[model samples]
Target: MSHTEQAMPRRAGQQGLWVLVAVAVSLALLAGCGDDGPTDLQPDAGTEPEVCGPSDVWCKDQTIDRLDLLTTVSTGEVREEGTTSGEFLTFVDSRAGGLSPTMSYSYLRFTPQGLTPVQIHDQESLGSTDWDLAVRRYTLRVNSGTSGPSCVSVANTPEGTTFASVTAVNAAMEFKTEAWFDTACTLIPDDSGLNGPLTQLGGFWAYTSCVQMTGRVFVIRLADGRHVKLEVTSYYEPSAQQVCNQTGSVPQPSGSGAIRIKWAFLP
Candidate 1:
């Protein structure tokens, strides 16, 4: 069955969704080290009715705001499979190095068909020869926006307006939760490319200090074209140095945190 067909009819008041963490024994997948690009397999863009009635599962009576999802710190183990209450697939970055308090990555795979999320070890492992298992993916660039708590944003695109790989979303204007949405089913895409938000010197995913991610917001585009706005509400783990004595020692698990998000399938 297709993704849209599998979407369950849910209301907006759902809260306190707990995400369970699973440790996979698979090897770590390094980034920017391989030739494999993002998977080209796009989910079937099933059509939605022009007018959604109150009982339609695909229709949103009201846009859900500030829904919280929890993730455990990255313990060097891959979050091979997990699902959020929002029905979004969440995963941890399975790189071998210890999770840097300042630098870390995770992913959200949007499969409307209720497909289980997969742990991606590296770029080359993104797509398989088997067509049915292939999934479209994006990199989660976790960082502090402007001068607030750590915010979650996408690294591939500079802004959420147009889909591109070279530019990143502006940290100043587009990095806050309020900037991504206006109301139910209404979204304003970030058209400002270099002019939108600016990241720290090393870029969006670059880590500076332990408390750098305290406040920020991130907007991500799912495979099915839905937009999710995210904010890092809290951190549940300690710094990498605090967890591991030496950089070489098996780094302590780190990336887990609390995320508050607002999502909708806008036209």
Candidate 2:
């Protein structure tokens, strides 16, 4: 979905919901190293709801017995997959990553009366959350008005005066617990380009990838007082000396260059 089209339905009282931004850059894709100028894969508009694949969206290892927590992947992967309405799809800043919750954990559901936008650092624990969804509980360090403690949260729950809506702001905190790995990504050259130096860089950069971005990451205060951050966030910085080896005497011992997303922006 487009950025501007994203809507908020949470009631106020809560301010500064942690929102991660994922911005990937592809010089090859933008440079037209292939046949098509842009990857013409028609992004399924909200028009025809398609099937929700498990990977499309789901609570990993979550028990379906609880009922409405989540539906089948084919049930609501995207807006089109589910019913005709747009409520089934909760599209956050995915330029972010996946946040899947397991079925064996205890979670709290809150319905607010008003929802407003505010930025905060630390707040009260809305409730004990389990990203892994195991028996372990993680403290929820909310973005309070003043960057408060590791736990606690503030909310604008249906006072009636303000236009309010409630949302599971911490769903990702309840799931998507994988830490960012600087070594899990790589780069590939544009071989489709018959030009001079274009073919030489093909796949030559995969082993030379040095960008590690844990975009939209946060130091969340868990139920136990421990702190955690989400993956594919801005805090992720890959080691520079971990990519391609042009020679036995490479200057930095590895590549330390961050990948460029033609239209990248700092979070």
Candidate 3:
């Protein structure tokens, strides 16, 4: 072998050492993004499902787990009012849609069987609408009705993951979201964080509580990485007073707090 080839063995050996080191670092990833194990359920981010049958809402080649409470996010703040102000979130791509679009990917987490909380502007867990949307699209419905909202179903998209939507009736169904092979999302192989362009991939997966909407189309967007466009109406932010007016759905409508989490992959 040439001189360069002769020296390759040492370099390769060093890389092997690095791989081992990385494997033994801290097992941080083994834990969820927030903490890395099961802590206390205080509504950090938080139900289900119906219409096309809750069990039917899933990706064939992907797996996921999620939960949602029939809750609301009503911060007293004027800017964020009845929106994901300081409380919880409960909608998907109510932006623009058809009626029966296929989904892409998604994942969701929830308390065993009770109402949970959602922390707005939850910076610690890389929380944000876009990030939340990403996870929601990949995990749950575009417009879920764990509370009372209606019109939920998946939409048709060009290609990729679009959170399936379903109606809200009085059904308390257990559900999950999933995805399959997607190459378009390749640009963003590691979107759990700020890895690369939020693109769609041929392969995807997710799980969530429930989805509620009435669109029959979907759009796989390449903007800000991989985002699925559900065929539904726009997400309308409710007024603080309006949200507060509706009681029993959740306890506190307008409140702000930080979110801490610890999770592990469910079998």
Candidate 4:
């Protein structure tokens, strides 16, 4: 749907109601004023209702399920064989180019077996269901919202929870879509690392002039309802000689956008 025409019934709240009430009161007063006044207070018979303002618009359409669009591909062999039952795979060079405004995002698809890189980039990714998550530097976007058409969303795990501890998806867990704007259509700041808004899955890391992983684990609920627990392992390249402190402050930072994540499909 067009951004302006999005079905945002939630925005038609007390303000809209009050507008109607005020109009009714004005019409009633006009009716009592004189019989000479022309009667049709409403719009002409064939005329459309007033259009809602930009702030009144919202998007609630159900996302396209990517499971139906899965193309057969060779899955990457499970790597790291970590402490948990889940697989740990690191995606190097998620930072496509330097932070140019025109730089394209690196896209990847998550499957039950492993992660695969998606070739298509730019606006075309929004229409394709082949990809689940798109990364550019530290910022991330799922297949939903202004990002794409699929219904991928995420639920953040509680504090101090290990990846192995989160085995099943909680029925009551709150899932968040890729929301970039406030109710007033303002862009929420990414603050720490980038110029964009902080997305649902992008909360994995925090900034303090230098970037650091928040150690937050998230349960990603794919478009088809399967859950995968994910943790961002590192933002710096493991091979780099200069290591930053626990606070993620380094004198000459290299490998700023190189990202590695640990994830496993939950039962």
Candidate number of the best lDDT: 4
> Where does candidate 3 stray beyond 4 Å?
1-115, 126-233, 237-267
Q: What does each candidate score in C-alpha RMSD? A: 27.1, 29.4, 20.8, 19.1
lDDT by candidate, in order shown: 0.28, 0.22, 0.27, 0.64
TM-score for predicted model 2 compared with the true structure: 0.15
Candidate number that wins on TM-score, 2 or 4:
4
Model 1: per-residue Cα lDDT over 1-267, one tens digit each: 666555532222222121111112122243442546453544334753222111211111221121111123223332323244533333333332333232222323334443233333222121211111211111132222221122323432233333212133344533221123343544333332322223221121213233223234345533322444443322323354333222322233544342222222223
Model 3 misses residue 174 by how many Å?
19
Tens digits of per-residue lDDT for model 2 on 1-267? Answer: 554444443422123332211112355445566545444665536544322211211221121221112221111111111132212211111111122432212222211211111211011111112121111011121221111111222222222221112222344333222211112321222333322111111221322133222122222233333232222111111233221222212335332222211111011
| Residue 30, candidate 3: C-alpha displacement in angstroms | 32
TM-score of each: 0.29, 0.15, 0.18, 0.64
Off by over 4 Å in 1: 1-95, 99-108, 111-116, 125-208, 234-267
**Which of candidates 2 and 4 is the stronger one according to lDDT?**
4
Candidate 1 residue 177 Cα shift, in angstroms, is 19
